[model samples]
Target: MITTNIPKLRQFYKIKAILFLSLIISTSSCAQLLQIVEQTPLSDLKLSQLDISNGLKGALDKGVEKQVTKLTAIDGFLQNELVKIVLPEELQIIDTKLRQIGLSSLADEGIKVLNRAAEDAVKEATPIFTDAIKNLTFSDAKNILMGNNTAATTYLESSTSTALYSKFNPVIQNSFEKVGATKVWSNIISKYNKIPFVKKVNPNLTDYTTRKTMDGVFKMIAVEELSIRTTLNSRSTPILKKVFALQDNR
Candidate 1:
């Protein structure tokens, strides 16, 4: 009985082989499917790289918008303790003496003027920072994304420090004049010197504020960088999510 159906059995086996070959051909020839497989590693790398670059750029932009811009505003530095300019080391004694003699308001005004000078100086920061961001190479971008929490800040400092100093110094000098910081300090110091027992103190406040304001700007940038690198919630955009997701896996 089995021998009588041998030809039919042969036909069934042939059909099965045909189906298997067809499946292989379809799988191999499907462009979309094959493309997906080909992109597995490359797409991941590209996506991760892009996310990191965008995240860093976003953080810097936000810092400039939120923190730096405020510092450039009228009372930005005067109001914020974190970046407020204080009397220089040599002038601290004069400040203390002024405050002690019922001249607290005068002393406070002196302090405010220093901060105001800083605020005025910060108006020049965006261009320097933008140049730094624009110059970021692919290697720098990768390092910033995958390196430590302050990687982007470090890159900024390295890339922009010399240029920033060159840029900030003049602006700070001008700001000192524009905000009347020079006159305010002169008044405060004059009052202090007029006190019977006190020696005169005149310090280069413009230089001090310039350096301090630069430090403040960098400090704010570092804060934003750390937030994005350490806090999951800081990855606000889709690219940030995907890039940081891969980072989490690693």
Candidate 2:
């Protein structure tokens, strides 16, 4: 009589299950490998160090020309809500108190003058930014290109903030004087100080305005840098397209 061996039958089924699992795992792994291979094409593998460096420089130059130029123009900071200089924390209470007391016009003028000072001071930034961009090395280019969208702007800010602050502070101080912001703010603060039973404020306007002006400059550049990194059409030049393309793969 023919009889089935229970142990042999169990071992054969277990082996079949193991083989099926192995097949599934191998297929999934191959699919993942194929995806990785497709993401990084062979064409970009030959991109040279100099090409990447120049491409990053070109992108920054375009960003500076487009965005920083706007900051230097009349009403650039005042009109642009993105980078407009608002009152510091110490001054906001003064603004609110004045507006509540029917001194809204004065509050408005106080804010307007701060933005005007920023617009004037940002005019000095383009040269500093250009010098920084020109000095970018290959290592910086590789790291920045592979980094997040605003990486280039962050690099520029870190490398140039100290010099920029030194350059912008005096200019911002002078701009406050030139644009009559000093007088306007003085009047606002004097009136606010005179209000009954309110805490007095005598914040340093020069330091505040200088820092805000630099912040606006970097913010605008970041906007452009992000656009170039994310938006396909914003890469206006050939070098930008080629270098940033490598970043796209990552």
Candidate 3:
């Protein structure tokens, strides 16, 4: 063309520049929208399709098998600070007084025997806990997965605590007798009872130890469940990996 109108040419290029910029912006926005849509369906598909219930049960079984099973062995409770049974509140003073009076060895024996009985009684829990996990419902599993770190353990406690207490109480009583805790505590209590200025104490050790032992078991299981959920390294099973991935992304 004859000498181009310089200003008009400049204006024309500016217009093209604006149009090109707008097209790029539009393309970027469309890509973002497409990504969002693609991700939404994938997430929905994962939640709706995955068999999380069995995976959750499997996780619990692993906890019981690996952690709880250890509590059944000799010195398991005594040696493990995490699950060690200590003196109950009513008996704490008794423990102190017995020690003060040069009966420290007896006091120590009494404490050891309590843990021993707990180790013995814990054997009964594995079967009951297995049965409870086997009966875990999908509703429970989903809520637990989305719940707080200890939610699974809280559910287990709520579902199993009462029945376990009833089952464990009797065994704890028997275990106390078998492990010689009954007689050992009898001696400790007798010695403490004879101490001057001490209030006479007759605690229901069977009930106390039963409750403490259950608490230790639940606490240990919660630790394992938390590890499996939050730490990718602790996902020892494929189901644990797949199921916990939901929590990870959420």
| Highest TM-score model number | 2
After superposing candidate 1, which stretches have Cα over 4 Å from the reference? Answer: 1-51
Q: lDDT winner among the candidates?
A: 2
Q: Candidate 3 regions off by >4 Å?
A: 1-50
lDDT of 3 by residue, 148-245 (tens): 99888898899899888998999999988898888988877788888888899877788889999999899889989989987898888777888888
Per-model root-mean-square deviation over C-alphas: 10.8, 7.2, 8.3
Q: Write the per-residue lDDT of candidate 2 for residues 109-156, one digit (tens) a residue.
A: 988888888888888888898899989998788789988878999999
Error of 3 at 59 (Å): 0.8
Ranking by TM-score: 2, 3, 1
lDDT of each: 0.75, 0.87, 0.84
Relative to the unseen true structure, what is the C-alpha lDDT of residue 248 in candidate 1, on a scale of 0 to 100? 62
lDDT (0-100) at residue 195 of candidate 3? Answer: 87
TM-score of each: 0.75, 0.81, 0.80
Number of the candidate with higher TM-score, 1 or 2: 2
Q: Write the per-residue lDDT of candidate 1 for residues 156-183, one digit (tens) a residue.
A: 8887778878878888788777877778
Cα displacement (angstroms), candidate 2, residue 185, comes to 1.4
Q: In candidate 2, what residue range of length 10 has the lowest lDDT sum?
A: 35-44
Q: How high a TM-score does candidate 1 get?
A: 0.75
